[model samples]
Target: MTERPNMETRTILRVIVCDNDIRKIVLPLKPQTVDSLLEQLEEKLGLQYKFTLQFEDPDFNNSLVNLTDIADLPDKPTLKIVSLVTTPTPSTADTEILSVASDDPCHSLRTAWPETFEIPNFPVDVEYRLRQGNLQYMRDQTYLQLSGELKHEILEKLSETIYSYKAYPNKEDFEAVAAALIKKHPCLTQPGSSKGWNGWYDSLRWKMGNYRSKLRRAGCLEVSINGGKRRGQQPQRNVKRPKRFEINFLPNFPDGEDEASMESKRKEMVEEMKKRRLNSALIAQNMNSTFALRRKELIEKEPAVKNTVERWPALFTNGQKSNVNARRTAVLHGLPLLLGEDPTDFYKTCFDCDSNEDMLDTAIGIMTVIPEDSPTVPYSLHLDATTTAIILEGTVVVDNLENVPQAMCLLFGLIYALNLEYPAALKSTFDFLQRVILSLGHKSLKPKIQSLKKSPNAVMFFHG
Candidate 1:
């Protein structure tokens, strides 16, 4: 028998030759030596100078391998070609000039350079490009420290860029501006820095917002008051102000009238009152007694009685009396009445469990076993056991019970019942309870209560 070669499969390798000139070459999986690959590169690229091949790892850490050694290349292999030639170094004066230019603020902006320096025009249109460069140059470390006129100039240039482009200073624009500022002035991002990027970004956004608002307001004013103006036309400078009118405080006064004129005026007033059907005694009675009783009835029936009282405070308070506590109690009592149950009986059955700890524990246990289909085996075993380890034993569990799921379910049951009998009270109590749960940080109870809110049993709990 003769040994066979696996010719059924082949691997293609992507090779990158990096040097003064970079090139990419692909090679097939064949039993070729390393020297053969180099020869192919030399022939293809027309290399006249001798070069050494190295793997393109960081700092060229891989050892130099023998050219005759078989190369075990992976699917994509990157190789470098280095020429054996010495390059000239810059003179000390040239190095010093380069260093100074990098530190100079005006290096990036030729227009802002010394007045004696003349910049030759390039073939490309560079006005917008130069403006962008100057905008970035404003963030340089040296420029960051400059104040007064220079700072104002930077802001003016930024405003001009935004106006020219009509770019809104949104989150993306803010991030781009902040990133450029941080890259050029890293100290602005550091803690305790007086010139932080946050304040700078906020100031720029506020200026843009104010400028946009002023333009909008001006356009609206022109449209409403002056019907706007023609394009490219200056507004009239000496526009006349509208004339002001004086109001007569005593238009119907009879101060300088004779006896006949006064008598005629009195008769005319009586005739006008009669035509309007005005009765002074009835008006006085309604204002003193009937209106007060009707307002009290409205307050009692209104669900958001708190807001009603806030709007018309005189409804609950007079100069000599305040009924704040009385109204709050009425609302509290009316909440349970909305469920078609006696308020006293409901409170006695539910909230009155505070004094009886054993009954409260039993109620909690019953709530845990609700829905009937819940896995009761483990809970039953725990309940049957007398060992302290298996049983829950603590007074704080009942006393410190905040807005948990079970309590939320009970509250939802009340709300659903109120929804059926008295929808007005249901809406008010729902909003109030939501605020209470949010303030108590019991957000986890929300989903469970919402799920229960859709249950049919919530409307009539005795049926469940």
Candidate 2:
């Protein structure tokens, strides 16, 4: 009997890698998504996967085409694969310029040739990246050393002067060069050097160094000099240098006037206060406050406690001592005794007086988590229902809350602010609050706070 021929059917698929160029890759099986393919490669090859992908026609024979551009494909997957060979197309950076270190003036001019020159007319900004990736970014000194167009411009100004060399004299040598130049041109004064070659050289050096330092700080100039010497490298030609000079351009806020400017400014102050309050509260709650007592004589006589309940009906106005939100919430929460005070007024007497600075100073001493030598001192924050709302409004800005005198001041402030409308009477409550802050040292709360502060990332509040 004759043997029967067997027939089999298979779906043909091809893998193409998107890289400097596209190349076909033999994928054992078509992956459902790119992520699965990377997982398979990582597991099989024990390599961290990172690659761009494309698909090829089932036929697999031709100049490698970009499979990613095909209209029918779904979204690209995250899988990376290696095994794909590409005919990497060299970009403009592939062009090479051979150099023979010659003292010829032409060679000097060539040194000034920027690694890149922008084509202003081009629809898009175009730059020439040098083939030598490790070439140092040339400095202004290097460019000035070259007698190029820029050099010519400098030389023209000094032609009448006896100074022949266009090079900038070193600061130590500048006076000598200026004296010699001034003798030849009676019109040229020694002070001219301040704005002439010497001055330009010094200014350029300073600016370039500043610019390059900025680039390095930002990690933009990662390409090392000569591959890894870690020495000074010039910025690639035409690359914009990073800005380094600092000048305050914005209008300065007056001292102590947390006067709400725009809504944005108000929001910022509110948020800052809330964080301080929270930190203070947490510190206060954990203290051994049983021994804590207010300095009795320091307490001022109390005024008639205003009934704030009816005050909720009043519209927010300037010069009011209470914040609108504080009063409204107090009334809503049935805390009628605390009503009628404006919360936003910040202070009825002196606006700039920091009522909480003393508390913050105490917090710095009480906070053991913070090194006594730490540059930033612990700060005390005062928050009420409105202020607490400000702190938890978005995110906690303060980082070292555990080092605070009372970490839960924020919580207490929030509770009072949220559950009761008018803040507890300021004078008596602040004294009481101080005692509460001292209570944070109580043994029961210390560990809980330590655990909170020591957590790798302890966030006081999460933003919605």
Which number leads on TM-score?
2
lDDT of 2 by residue, 1-464 (tens): 97543323111232222111122233445455546655654454333224444332223212122334424333332221323221111110111111222332211111111111111111121111111111222321111122254333333333212111212223433344334332332222223365444643443345434443443343421211112233674533332211222111111122222223323332333343345232221111111010001101011222223422121111121211223332222222221112222222121111123243322222111111222332221111111211221122223323344312233354455545557332333332233233322333233433434343332111211100
Measured by lDDT, the strongest candidate is 1
Off by over 4 Å in 1: 1-143, 184-196, 213-464
Q: Number of clashes in every candidate structure?
A: 0, 51
TM-score of each: 0.17, 0.18
Q: In candidate 1, which residue pairs get closer than 3 Å at backbone N, Cα or C atoms, i.e. clash?
A: none
Which sections of candidate 2 miss by over 4 Å? 1-30, 38-49, 55-61, 69-202, 209-464
For model 1, give the RMSD to the true fold.
36.5
